[model samples]
Target: MTLIVGHRGARGEAPENTLASFAKALAAGVTRVELDLHLSADRQLMVIHDPTLKRTTGVRGKVAQHSAEDLQRIDARLGLPGWPEPCPIPTLEQVFGTFPDIEHYQLEVKSGSTAQSRIVLAAILQLVERFGLQNRVVVTSSSRTLLRTARDTAYPLATGLVEEYGLLDPLKSARRYQCRFLILKWTLCRPTLIQQAQAQGLHVSVWTVNEIEQMQRLIDMGVDSIITDYPHLAMRVLA
Candidate 1:
């Protein structure tokens, strides 16, 4: 059976990447969730997607420029309607604390384009060790260098490669990183690719899928996991 992984914590139902959104996903019976990470000025792993706060929180500045305590004040509702007011940014530690029952988590590290971005990998690895979630989390990045850094940390953790768009050979990429999972872009997922990856011992997990038809298609393709903004739709389609 294909498992549903909430995209940015049920992004279609609630604000993206917030505790409220994650809670909604878990309530919908989603055992896994996908989230993004950026380093705060104090080096805390903030859970918002964008490097700048303009899009999500409307706070106009680089996320790395603000201290965690300061970033907590801005609302991350992304100005969407119906969500509670003052939806502050959530730390990775906060998300882990709030939803301890989630079976699996896919965390994408959004850092700078270069090697400097790996600065947060050590912190994330430390948290994974502290939380005892070493087996439950997969750290991924589109940047191979950063992904390698995570794999080579003092306490290395499970690693996955977020394909650079839809073109890279999933099986080869997984082998290169020694990644057990491949975060395949939703559109790139096909039965042939899924079969090929699986044959190579790589579990294929497609991302950001929402439509029922597409969800059903992926399920039929036998993907190991489907990451969707609408976990409800994925559940229904699979059901």
Candidate 2:
């Protein structure tokens, strides 16, 4: 059975990556939660997507430039449509604690130096150990170095995200990182790709699939998981 993951915690219905969204996704029956992580200025692993707070938070600044103390006050909801004001930016550990029942976490490690990635991976691993989620997490990234770091750290599940635009052997890349799965953007994926990955003993998961037709196509193709902003709708479609 294909796993249904709530991309950024049911982003379509609630704020992406917020505790609220994660709770909603869990309530809606998603088997997994996909979230992005970045290092705060204080070197804490937090769960905001962009390198800068501009898009989601409406705060104009690099996330790495701000300390966790400063970021906590920045109001994460500045640009998100409806709000009395803004919401607090959540730390990765907080998100992990919120949905202990939904064990699988598709963790995207955003860019940083190799040293930075190691610290972030270590922090995540510590959280997994603390929560007993080692069996439930998959660390992933577009950066091969970051993926390799996670793999070296012995994360039970790791994935390398492949761009749809480029011509590259995803299986070979997964092999290089010793990853258990390969994640691809929607436009860059096809059923054949899923089959190929599976044939190589690697699992396949695709991201940001919003349309029903595309979701149906990938699910029909037997992807191991579908990462989407709307887990409620995806669950219904899968049902």
- Candidate 2 per-residue lDDT, tens place, 205-233, comes to 88888889988988888988888998889
* Superposition TM-score, candidate 2 onto the true structure: 0.92
How would you encode candidate 1's per-residue C-alpha lDDT over 1-239 as one tens digit per residue?
89999999989988998888899899888989999999888999999888889988766889999999998877899746678665789999999988888998999985464456556777887888899998998888787777666556533677787874766666776787788788888878778888988898877889878888888888889999989998887788877
lDDT of 2: 0.80
State each candidate's clash count.
0, 0
TM-score of each: 0.94, 0.92
Instruction: Please give the CA lDDT of all the candidate structures.
Output: 0.83, 0.80
Q: Give residue 127's lDDT in candidate 1 (0 to 100).
A: 89
Candidate 2 residue 113 Cα shift, in angstroms, is 2.1
